[model samples]
Target: MTGWLDVHAHYLTDRYTQACTAAGHHHPDGMPALPAWNPQDALAFMDAAGIAASVLSVSSPGVHFGDDSLGADRAARDLARHVNDFGADLVTSHRSRFGLAASLPLPDIQGALRELDHAYGDLRADAIALKTNYHGRYLSDPAFSPVLTALDAHAAVVTLHPTSPPGWQRTALDRPRPMIEFLFDTTRCVIDLALSGTLARYPRVRWIVPHAGAVLPTLAHRVAFVCDLTGTPADLPTALGNLHYDLAGTPLPVALETLLKLAPPNRLLYGSDYPFTPAPAALQLATALRQSPHLQDATLDLTPDSPGATLFPRLFAQQGRPEDRASPA
Candidate 1:
C-alpha cells in the first residue's frame, strides 16, 4: 500500500486568483490571502504527509466573483469551464497521484447544467465540488433543484464545501470565515437540504460532507426539533445517515465521535484540505487521522474497499489507470 488516500485536497492557480481579484475578492472567504499552489508543491506535500493520491478541488469563494458586466452568471460559467479544464489537464499529467473534482456555477440552472455535462462527460472528472451557498442562495433553494436532479441522474460524487454565508459579516465579528463560519455554514446547508427535502429527493447523489460533517453531527437532533416546532417534519436522520463524510480538519474526539453516532464508520474518507490548510497543519491532521483510535478498522487505510475510495474506485484500484480518467458520455 502506498499510503492513505486523501479525498479533500484543494488546488489554486495564479490565473484563478487573479480573476477572483479582478472580481474584488482579493481576500476570498475572509482569508488573509490565497495560498500558492502547483502540482509539484502538492505532490511534495502529499509525499511528505504519506498521501498516496488526492482528489483535488478548488476551495471556497469557488468560481463566481460578483455580478459583472460580462454578466456575472455567464462569467461564472466560463470560469468554471476553465477551472475544470485546468484540473483535467493536471490529472492527465499526474494520473496516478491526483484526481479532479470539477467545479460548477450554480444558481444559474442552465449554465450549471452545461458545465456539469462538460465536467463529467468531456473532462472525465472523478467528482463534483460544490459550495454550500451562492450569492446568499443555498443548495436547499428550489432554484438548485434542477442541478441536484442532474447530479442524481449521473450518481455523481459531490463534495460540499462551505463558504461565507450570506451576511456573515454581521455575526462573524471580524474573525476569519474558516475559523467558525465555514463549519456553521456547512451545518446550515445540511439543515436546509434536510428541511427542504433535497436530501431525500436526490437519493443517488452521494454527498461528501467536509470537516468531519462539520457541526452537522451536533445539529442532527436540533434540525428535527426545529422542524417539529415549525410543524414541518422531515426525516433528517435518514437523510444524514445516507451521506459520506471526509475527515478534513480537526476530527479528533468531538467531531468524529458525534459524526460516528449519526453515520457509519464505513462511510468515512480521508481528507487533507491542503494548500488552504497549510502543509504543516495538514500533515498534523493526517497524522491524527492515522492514529485515531476511533478509526482502527479495515477501511482506515483508504484502500479501494474504504468508504471514500468506493466513491472513486478508479483512483484507488490496485493499479489505478488514469489513462481513461473520465470517459465522456
Candidate 2:
C-alpha cells in the first residue's frame, strides 16, 4: 500500500512553457507561465494524497506543434532533450519519488526516432507519453511505423495521453465536453490501431492507454459488431489482450466494469491524471480496487506477482519478484 504511484501527471519545464507561450495558451488557472515545476511540490501533493511517487511527462500537444517550420523541427529536438533532461534531473535529485515519460516530436517521425534514441537509450524513461492524434495525423497512420518499430525493439512502455481532436474549438459555455471528446478520441485511435493491425504487427511495444482506457471498456462489444459487420478483421481481442490501461479520469465503477469486459484486472493500473484530476480520484481508485468483486477471480491465480502489481515491479518490489514482473501478460 505504501507503494502507491500516480502514473499520469504533467510536470512543466522550460520547453513546456515555451510551447504554451508560443501557442498563446495559458495554464488552466491563469497562473503566470512557468519555466519548470518543483518536484518537491509534487512530492507534497503525493504526501497529501498518500501516494509515494508519480510518473511524469509533458501534457498534450507536446513540442510537435512547436515544430511548425523546418527550423522549428530542429528547435523541437533541442527542446525535447531539454525537457527530458530536466525530467532526468528531477528523478535523480528526488530519488525514488518520481519517474519520467519522455516527450517526443511525434508527427515529425524522424525527429521522434532521434529523440527516442536519447530518451530510451540514455535516459531510460519509465515510459513514453504519446497523443492519439498529433498535429493532423492519427498515430495509427503508416508514417509512424519507424517510431513504433523503435518502441517495439526496446519494449518501451507507451502511455497514450488524450488530446482534443484536431480543430476542436471550445466555447465558453461548453467547457467540460472537450475532456469527454478527448476520451472518445483516445478510444477511436486505439480502435484504428487495432483495426489496422498495428497492434498485432508490433507485439513487443507495451501500450498503456489512459483515461480509464478511454471508451473501450464500455463500447468494446459495439466496436466488435461494427468491425465484424463492415468486413473489418475481427482481431481486436488479440490486440486488446496484450494491452494495458491506466484508470485515469474514469469513474471507479465505469473503469472496473470495463476491465471486467474488455480485459483482465492484471492489465489494469492506477492513474490519477493529476493536477487535472485531483487526489480524490486516486483514493477512489484504491477503494474501487479493494471493493470490486470483478477482481476476485483475477487476483486468485497469483503466478509470481499479484496479477495487478506486475506492471511496475520496480515500484512495487515488496509485492513480488522481478521474474513475476517480467512474466508475459
List TM-score per model, in order.
Answer: 0.93, 0.83
Backbone clashes, each candidate: 1, 0
**lDDT tens digits by residue: candidate 2, 1-329:** 35456677778865567667776655421323333456666676676665655788887657665545778788778778888888877766554567788989877788899889989788877778888888758977889999988988988778888776755654223454334677778888998888888887888888888876777877777778888899874856656766887666654655667565777767766666665554465566656665777656544221247433454444444323222212111
User: What's the C-alpha lDDT at position 142 in model 2?
Assistant: 89
After superposing all C-alphas onto the true structure, candidate 2 shows an RMSD in angstroms of 5.7
**Cα RMSD to native, each candidate?**
2.9, 5.7
lDDT of 1: 0.84
Q: List the residue pairs that clash in candidate 2.
A: none
Off by over 4 Å in 1: 68-70, 318-329
Q: What is the C-alpha lDDT of each candidate?
A: 0.84, 0.69
Weakest 10 consecutive residues, lDDT, candidate 2? 320-329
